[model samples]
Target chain A: MKDNNRLLSRMFKYKECYLLVAPFYIIFSIFVIAPIAIAIFFGFTDFNMLEPPEFIGLSNYLTLFFEDDVFLVAVRNTLIFAVITGPVSYFSCLLFAWLINELPRGLRSVMTFVFYAPSMSGMLYVIWAYIFSGDMYGLLNQILMSFGFVKDPVQWLTNTETMLGCIIIVQIWMSLGTSFLAFIAGLQNVDRSLYEAGAVDGIRNRIQELVYITLPSMGPQLLFSAVMQISAAFSVSSVCMTLAGFPSTDNAALTVATHAYDFGMIRFEMGYACAVTTVLFIAMMAVNKWIQKIISKYADV
Target chain B: MKFKRSKTGPARSTAGDTAVFMILIIVGLFMLLPFVYAIIQSLKPTEEIFAYPPKFFVRNPTFDNYKTLSQLVDSLWIPFGRYFINSAVVTVVGTGANLLFSSMAAFAFAKYNFPGNKWMFSLVVAALLFSGTVTALPQYIIMSGLGLINTLYSLIIPAAATPLGLFLMKNFMVQIPDTVIEAATIDGAGILKIYYRVCMPLVKPAALTLVIFSFQGLWNSTGGSYIYEEAWKLLPTVLNDVASAGIARVGSASAASVLMMLPPCALFIFTQSRIVETMAFSGIKG
Candidate 1:
C-alpha cells in the first residue's frame, strides 16, 4: 500500500511534464504508431477493403518472391534506384556543402539557394516534360541536332530504355535537398579552431583536415543525412509517377512504392500492399544498418 | 605533410577560386534550369509556349494566362476563392500547431527529468526512419474511422506531430541554457510560463525554420485521398487538376504552378540565412 502510494505520488509529480508532451504522443500514437501496427497486422491477412481480413500465413511473401514477376522487376528497379542514387547523392551533398562552406558568406547563400530551390519548389520539375519532349522542338533534340549528333529526337521519358535513366537524372538533381542543407549546417557547425589545431597537429591540408577533424565532429549530422537519403531513395515513386506514367511501359521505372500504391489504393488490396510494405521495411532496415556501419567508420576517425 | 592551411579560409589561389566559381555556376544553372523554364513558360503566350523550335526565352510574354485563370475560376464548379482559403487555413493552422506541439514535447524531453523520457525520444528518432508509404493505407483507415475523411482537419491534425519537427526542436532546445529556466522557476513561474515566455522566444529561429518546412509540406500536400470534396480540397490538388485538364489548359496550368510555388519560395528567401545560422549553431552547442 505504501509503495503504491509512493508510485502515485511520483506520477503526480511529473504530471505537468507529461501534460506538456501529451499532444504529440496522443496524435503520433493514433496517426503514426497505430497505422504502423495495423499495416504489420494486415501483412498477415487476406484483406481487400470490402471484406474482413482473413488470416493467410506467408502466402503474400511467397507470392512476392516466387510468383509475382512484376514485383521482382519492381524489386530490381528499386534496388537499382537505391544503389545508384543513394551514395551519389550523399557524396555530392557532402562535397558541395563542403565546397560551399569555404566560400564567402553572401555567395555561399546565393549558391545554396540556387541548389536548394529545385527540391523545395512544388512540381516545378514538370518543366522537364518540355525539355525532354519527344519532338523536333524539344530542347535536347534541338541541341543535339544543332551539333549534328543525332538526326532525330530521342524519346527521353517515354522509351523504356531511357525512362528510368531520365528519372534517375531528375532524382539526382533533387537529391541534393534536405540532406544537403543538413550537411551545410553540419560543415558550418564544425569548430573553426579545430582545423587550426589540426593544422598545427600535422594535418596537411583540407582533405586531411576533413578526414581527421570534420567528419568526427559532425557525426550526428552525418547519421541524420544518411537516414534522410535512405528514406528518400527508397520512397521515390512520386517522381517516377509524375515523370513516367504510374505503370511505366514494361515496368521499367516501377519502384516498390508505385507497386504498393497500385495494390493498396488503386486495387484495394490492402493486405498485399502491407505485405509489400513489410518487405520494403525489412530491406530498408538492413540498408540503414549497412549505412550506419559505413558512416560510423568515418565518425570514429 | 608539407601543405599548409589558409588562415583566411580553406587555402586557394586565384586560378583555384575561379575554377570553384565556374563549377558552382555550372551546377547552379543545372539546378535552376527547371524553375527558369517554368517561370518563362508561365509568362509566354500560348503560341510561343508550344512553338516548333521551342524558345528558351519568352518572345511574346503576356498576363493572358493569369487573366484566363481568373475568368475561368468558377467554371470548375468550385469557387477558386475557397481553394485559396482552404489552402491558407490548412497550411497556417497545421504549421502553427506542428511548431507548438513539437516544441512543447521537445521542451519536456530536453528540460524535464521525467520517467520514460529517453525511451520516448528514441521512439521519435526511430519514427523518423519510417516512410509515409508504409503508413498511408492505415492512416486512411484511421482517418475514415474517426470520420475525418473529406475534412481539412484530416490533413491538419495528422501532420501536426511529425517526428522531424520534434527532433529538430529537441536538438535546438537541448542547447538552451538551463539557468534561465531555473531563474524563471525561482520567480514562481511554472513550466508552461517559462516555455511560452522564455524558451519559446529564444528558439524563434528554429521555429521559423520549422514554419518554412511545415508550410511547404502542407501547401504541397494533395487531398486526393482525404478530401475529394471540391470545397475542402487544397491548392496542390486543384493545381494538379488544372495541369491535367488537357493541353489547352497547359499554359494556364504553368501559371497556376508558378503561383503555387511563390509563397514557399518567398518564405525560403526571407528565412534562408537565419535557418542556416540556427541549424549550424544547434548541433555543436548542444
Candidate 2:
C-alpha cells in the first residue's frame, strides 16, 4: 500500500509537468498536423472540397511523373533557385552580421535598420517591381541606357532568362536581416576567452581565428538558417507571382509553390496539385531531416 | 606578426576602421540607391515617372500625388485613412494577443511541472515546418463555421497563434534562471501571480523581440482576401493590381506603392534602437 502511494504521487507530478506544455501540442495537432494529413489525402484522390473524394491513387503520381510539363518546370526552377541563392545568401548574412557586430554599440542598431529596411518594409515587391519593370522608364533600364548599353531597353522580367534572376535578386535582398541577426546573436554567445586562448596559442589574425573558431562556434545557428533557406527557397512564391507575373512570359519564373497554387487553386486539379505539393513536401522534409541530423551533432539550441 | 608586439598599443583601430568604413560605404550605397529612387519617383510629376533615362533626382517636387491619394478618402467602400486604421488595429491587437498567449504558454512549458509536456513541446517545435499556405484551406473552413469569415477576427485570431513567435519566446525563456522562480514559490505566490509579477518581467526582452518580428510579419504581409476583407484588400494586393495594369495606372500605382512602404520603413527606424537593445539582451549583441 505504501509503495503504491509513492508511485501514484510520482505519476501525479509528471502529469502536472505535462499539463504545463499541453496548450502548444493541442493547438498544433489540430491546425498543423491535421491539415497536412488532409493535404496528403487530398493529393491521393479527387477531392475538391465541394465534391466527395473519389480515390484515384497512383494516377496523380504517374501523371505528375511523366505527363505534366509544369511539374518538371517547377521542380527544375526551384532546385536551380535554391542552388543560386542559398550559399550566396548565407555568406552575405554572415558577412553582414560580422560587420554589424564590429560596429560601435550606439550606431550598430541604426545601421542594421538600413540593412534590414527592405525586409521590414513588406513592400519589397512594390518597390522592386517598379525598378525592374519592362519599360525603358524602369530605373535599372534607365541606368543601362544612360551608360549606352542598350539601344532602347532590355526587357528584364518578360524574358525567359532574366525573370528568374530578378526573383532571386529580390529574395536575397529581403532575406539578409533575419539570418544576419541570428548570426550576430550566435557570435555574441561565443566566449571571448576562447579568442584570447587562440591568440596566446599563436593564432595569426582575425581571419584565421574566424575560420577556425568563430565559424565552428557559429555552426548551429548557421545550420538552422541554412536548412531553413533550402526549404524557403523551395517554397518560394507570391513575389514571383506578383513581381514577374504568374505563367511568367516564358514560364521561366514558375517556382514549386506557384505551380502548386496554380494547379491547386487556379486550375482546381486538386489531386494532381497535391501530388506535386507532396513532392515538394517530401523533398523539403528529406533535406530538413538530413540537416536536422547535422544540426543534432552541433546545435545546442 | 608583422607589427612588433608593443605592450602599450596606439589604438590599433585605424586599420580595421578603414576596412569597416569601406564595407559600410558599399553596403550603404547598395541599400540607399533603391530607396532614393523610390523617394525620387514619389516626388516627381506623373509624366516624368515614365520618362526615358529615369530621373535620379526630381526637378520639381510636389505633394500633388500624396494630396490626390489622401483625397481618395471617398472611394466607395473604403478610404485610405480607413484602410490605414484597419491595418493598425488588426496589427496592434494581433501582436498583443501573441505576446500574452504565447508567453503564457511558453512560461507554463518553461517553468511548470505538467504532464505530457516533453512530447507536447516537441510536437509544437516540429510543427514549424508547416507553412501558412498549407493551413489556409481548412482554416478558412473553420473560420467560416465560427462565423468569423468576414470579420477582423479572421486576421487577428490566426495571426495571434504564430508558431514562430511561440518558438522564439520558448527558446529565450529556457535561458531564464530557475532560482528566481524558486524564490517566488518561497514567497507563497500563486501560479498566476508568480507568472504576472515575476516571470513576465524576465521574459520582457524576448517578448519585445517577438513584438518586432510579429509586427513586421503582420503588417508587411499581404493577407489574402479570405482574411482581411470580404473583398480581400491589402496594400500588396492593391499594388499587385496596379503593377499588372501599370501602363495606364502609373500615377495611382506609384503613389500607392510609396504609401504602402513608408509606414513600415518609418516604424523600422523608430524601433531600430530597440532592436539593438533587444539583441544585446538576448545576447545577440556586439
Candidate 3:
C-alpha cells in the first residue's frame, strides 16, 4: 500500500511532462504506429480492398518467396542497390565533409550549397530524361554521333542491361543529402582542444587525427549518419519509378518498394503488398542493428 | 554559435588538396548543370527545343512558356489560386504544429525524468526505420474511416509527428545543461514557461533546422491519394497533371517545374548557411 501510494505521487509530480509530450505520442500512435500495426496484420491475410480481408495463414509469404518470380527479382535488386549505394554514400559523405572542413568559411558554405543543390531542386531528374531520350536530340546520342561512336541512338531506359546502371548513377548523384549534411555537422563538433592535445600526445598527422580522435569524438553523429544512410539506401523506389517506368524493362530497376507499390496501389492487393513491405521493414531493422554494432566498435576508439 | 571553426591552423596546401579542389569543381558543375539546362529548356521556343542537335543554349529565349502557363490556368475548370492556397495552408499549419509538438515531446524526453521515457524513445527510433510505402494503404483506410480523406487534416495531422524531427529535437535538447532548467524551476517558472522562455531560445538553431526540414517536406507533399477531388489537389499534383498533358505542353511543364522549384530552393539558400551553423552547434557534446 505504501509503495503504491509513493508511485502515484511520483507520477503526479511528473504529470505536466506527460501532458506536454502526449500530443506528439497520440498523433504518432494514430498515423504512424497504428498504420504499421494494421500493415503487419494485413500481411497474414489476402485482401484486395474491395472485399473483407480473409486470413490465409502464411500463403502470402509463400507466394512472395516461391510463386512470384518478379518478387524475387525485386529482392535481388533491392539488396544490390542497398549494398552498393549505402557504403559508398556513407564514406563519400565523410570524405567530402573532411575535405570541406579544411576550407575557409565563405568557400565552405558555397561548396556545401552546391553539393546539396540536387536534393533541394524539385524537378532535377527530368534533365536525365532529356539526356537519355533515346533520340538524336538526346545529349548523349548527339555527343556519340558527333564523335562517330555508335551507328544508332541507344534506348537507355528500355535496354535492360543499362537501366539498372543508369538508375544507380542518378541515385548516387542525388545521394549526397541528409547524411552528408549530418557528417558536416558532426565534423564541426569535434573539440578544437582535442586536436592540439592529440598533437602533443604524439599524433603525427591528419590521418591519425581522423582515425583515432575525430571519429571517436563524433560517435553519436556517426551512428546517426549510419542509420539515415541505411534507411535512404533501402527505400529507393520513387526515384526508380520516376526515371524508369514502374516495372522498367525485364524488371531491371524493380525494387521491393516499387513491387509493393505495384501490388498495393495499382493492383489494389493490399495484403500481398503488406507482406512484401513487412519483409522490407524487417530487413531495414536488421541492417540498422548491424550498423549499430559496427559503429559501436569504432565509437570507443 | 559558429560551431564550424577549423580545429587546426591554416596548413600549407599540398598536391592532395589541389586534386580535391579540382574534383570538387567538376562535381559541383555536374550537380548544378541539370537545373541550369532545365531553366534554358524552359525558355526555349517549341521548334528550338525539338530542333536537331538540341542546342545547349537557347537562341531565342522568351516568356512564351509563362504566357502559355497563364493561358492553361485560364482554361482550367478550377481556379489555380485554390491550389496555391491549399499548399500554403498545409505548409504553414503543418510545419507550425510539427515544430510545437515535436519540441514539446523532445523536452519531456530530454529534461524530465518520466516513466516509459526510454521505451518511448526506442519506439521513435523504430518508427524512423519504417518506409511510407508500407503505411500508404492502411493510412488511406484510416483517414477515410475517420472522415478526414477530403479534409486537409489528413495531410496536416501526419506531418505533425515525424520521428526524425522529434529525434533531432531531443538530441539538441539533451545538450541544454540541466542546471539551466533547474535554475528556471527554482525561480518559480512552470514547465511550460521554462520550455518557452528558457529552453526554446537556447535551441533556436535546432528549431530553425526543423523549420527548413518540415517546411520543405510539407511543401513538396501532394494531397493524400484519397483526396482525388479536383478542388483539393495541391500544387505539385496540379503541376504534374499540366506536365503530363502531352509533349506539346513540354515548355509549359518546364515552366511549371521551374516555378515549383523556386520556393524550396530560395528557402534553402536563405537558411542553409544558418542551418549549417545551427547544426554545427547541435553536436552531441561529449
Candidate 4:
C-alpha cells in the first residue's frame, strides 16, 4: 500500500513539472504559431488587416516572382551578401576564436569583449549612419578627401553598385560577435588528444592540423554558421535602413524583409506582403535543405 | 646530404600558409580599424576636429564630447539619465526572467519523459526558426493592441521568452547528469523546488550565457514602433531622432552612440572569453 502511494505521488510530481513549463507553450502557441499560420494562410489570399480575407490563390507569389523588380533585386542582393559575407565572416570569427583560445583565460576573455563589443554595441547604426551620410561631412568622405584618395564626397550608401557591399561590411562588423563566441566554444571543446595524436603522426604545423582535424571536428559549427549567415542575409533590414533612410535610398538596399515592411507595414499591402514572405520562406527552406544535402554528400566524401 | 633531405613524413605549410596568415591578420586589423579611428576622432578637441588632414591620434584631447553630450540631447524624449535606467531596468528584468523561465522549461524537457514531450520539444525548437528579425511586424501590432508601445516593458515582455534561450538551456542541461534529478526527487522535493534550487544552480554557466545574450538583445533594440507611437524615451530609439536632426546635434549623436554601446562593450569585455567558450555557445562546432 505504501509503495503504491509513493509511485502515484512520483507520477503526480512529474505532472507538476509539465505544468510548470506549460506557460511557455501557451504563450508561444498564441503569439508565434498563430501569426505564422496567419502569414501562410494570408499568403494565399488578398486580405489586408483592414479587410476580410479573400482567396487570391498564388497571385501574390506570381506577382512577386514574375513582376516585382524589387523582389528580384532583394533576392539578388541577399544571395550576393550571403555568398560574400559567408566565408569572410566565418573565417574571421574562427581566427579570432583561435587567437583568443591560445592565450591565458583572463586575457582571452578580455580580447573576446574587444571583438564582441561591436556585436551589441549601441548606435552602431547611428555611427555608421553618420559615417555613410550622403553629404560631405560624412566620415568616410571626409577622411578620403583629407587623404587625397578622392577629390569629392561619394554617395556610398546611395549608389546601387556599392550600397549593398557597404551594408554587408558594416553587418559583418556589427553582428558577428555571437558567431565568434560559438567558434570559441567549439574550439575549447576540441579534445586535446586529437592535436597530440596529429603531432605524433608528424603533422608539420598548424595549417595541416587545422585542415585535417580542426575543420572536421568543427563541421557542426561550420554548418551552424552557414545556417546563420543565410538567415541573417535573408533578414537584412536595419543595417540598410540606418545606412540609407527608409525607402532605402532609391530602394536599392531592399531585402525581402524590407520589401515586407514596404508592403505590409508602409503600404498596407498585407496580403501581397504575406505572399512575398511566403516566397522568401520557401526559398530559404529549399536552400537550407540543399545545403544539408551537400554537407551530407561531403561527409560521405 | 642535409638532414632536410632525409624525410617527407608530413607536408610543411608552404608560402601559401604564410600568405594566408598575413592576409587574415590584415583582415582582422581592418575589422578593428574603424572603431580605433572612431576612438581617435572622439578624443580630438573641437578646434583641431576640422584639421585639413585628420589626425590619426589626437594631440590635445578633451572630454568636450562627453560634456556636450548631455546638453545636446532633447531631455523631453531621451532624458539622459532615464535612458540608462530604462535600458538597465528592461535588460535586467528581461534577462533575469529569460534565464529563470528558460532554464525551468529546459529542465522539464531534458529530465521528464511525459507523453507529447518530444512533439513539444520539437515545437520549442521550431520557435528558433521564427526570430525577432521576421516577427517584428506581428509583434509590433500585438504590442500596440496591448497598449505597451513606449514603456520599458515594451522591450522586456515580447522578448522575455526567446526560443534560442530555451534551446541553449536545454542543450546545456542535457549534458547535466540524470542522477542529480533522481537524487533531488528522492529527497522529497517538489518539481518547482528542484528547478529553482537544484537545476538553477547547476545551469549557472548557461544562465550567464543567456544573461549576456538577452542583455545584448534588449539593449540593442532601436525604436520599437509601438514605443515611438506613444513616447520616445530609450537610449537606442533616441538614436533615430539624433540621426534625423542633421547638423544641430551631430556630435551628440556620436556621443549617444558611444554611450549606448559602452555597457555592451563592457559586458563583452568582462565576459569576453566566457562569452565565447561557454556563455555565447555561438555554436563554434564549425
Off by over 4 Å in 4: A1-20, A129-153, A190-224, A245-251, A292-301, B1-28, B44-60, B72-83, B107-134, B144-151, B171-206, B228-232, B238-246, B273-286
The superposed Cα distance between candidate 2 and the true structure at residue A152, in angstroms, equals 4.9
The model with the greater lDDT, 1 or 3, is: 3
**For residue B79, what is the lDDT in candidate 1?**
75
Per-residue lDDT of model 1, residues B1-286, tens digit only: 1112232544345665666678888988999999888888888898887787777899878999887776667677877888889989999899989999999999999888787898888677666656556587778889999999999989899779988788777755654667878889999998888889888766665677677778888888887589987789887787777666778777888888888888988887777777555545543322
Worst lDDT 10-window in candidate 3 chain B: B3-12
Clashing pairs in 3: none
Tell me how large the interface RMSD of candidate 4 is. 6.5
State every prediction's TM-score relative to the real structure: 0.88, 0.84, 0.90, 0.79
DockQ of 3: 0.48
Q: Per-residue alpha-carbon lDDT of model 4 for A146-208, expressed as tens digits?
A: 889988788888887778878887887865665676666555545455665787888776667
lDDT of 3 by residue, A1-301 (tens): 9998987888799999898889999999998999999999999999998999999989999999989999889989999999988998889888887877666677887887777777776457868978877877888788887889988998887788888778887887787877676666556556666876786788765677788888887666677778778888887898888878876988899999999999988998889999998888899999998888988888841
Model 4 scores what on Cα lDDT? 0.66
Using Cα atoms, each model's DockQ against the true complex is 0.43, 0.30, 0.48, 0.24
Cα shift from native, residue A294, model 1 (Å):
3.6
Give lDDT: candidate 1, residue B144: 96
Docking class of 3: acceptable
Per-residue lDDT of A1-301 in model 1, one digit per residue for the tens? 9998887787688788899899999999999888887888988899998999999999888988899999989989999999999989998998888777666766777888888888777577767777787787778888888889988889888899999899998898988877787677566556566776775788755667677888887676687678778888987888898888877889899988888888988888888888898788778877887888887787741
Deviating ranges (above 4 Å) for candidate 1 = A1-17, A191-204, B1-7, B10-16, B74-79, B107-115, B170-206, B276-286
Full candidate order by DockQ, most accurate first: 3, 1, 2, 4
